[model samples]
Target: MLSAGNPYVLPSVLVAAGAYLAATLLTDASLLVRIGLLAVLAGVVPIVLNRLLGGGSADEWRDDPIEDPGDGGADADESREA
Candidate 1:
């Protein structure tokens, strides 16, 4: 049950950057105001991004299709013993 359509990395980075920008640009705003806006942004960004990104769960990655290649070892390792 692997997923091939959920590319959430970009959306997360974008949302985080947006939140950080929103927090950083409020230089004259009060501390409470800054905290509140940051809090709301932190809370809302993931939820929106999740919905926008198909809302898959950890289970969706259980059976990764790409096989592991043993730490990118050299061809010699293929014949060497442990």
Candidate 2:
């Protein structure tokens, strides 16, 4: 999910960083609390980014079906007969 081709990666990272900085600098939260905010943002930012980027399609994987070699096991059967 963190690959270079992923459109949401950069946005997620930036949002998570912003969230962390805001929680730390704008509030009087403790270290553990700020870390907890970061953790939650890390998990949720990607999902929110996905939705915002129009990546909510559930049938995306269906677009690419696995290719068959076209022999349908005939080559293996002929070799066995020999």
Estimate TM-scores for all models: 0.40, 0.47
What is the lDDT, from 0 to 100, of the residue 82 in candidate 1?
Answer: 50
Task: Flag clash pairs in model 1.
Answer: none
lDDT of 1: 0.59
Error of 2 at 62 (Å): 14
Which candidate number has the best lDDT? Answer: 2
**RMSD value for candidate 1:** 6.3
Q: How far is 66's C-alpha from truth in model 2 (Å)?
A: 16
Model 2 clashing residue pairs (backbone): none
Question: Candidate 2 on 1-82: residue-level lDDT in tens?
Answer: 3344456666767777898899888999999988877766666666666767766343565576577657867897898999
The 10-residue segment of model 1 with minimum total lDDT is: 1-10
* Model 1, position 51: C-alpha lDDT score: 69
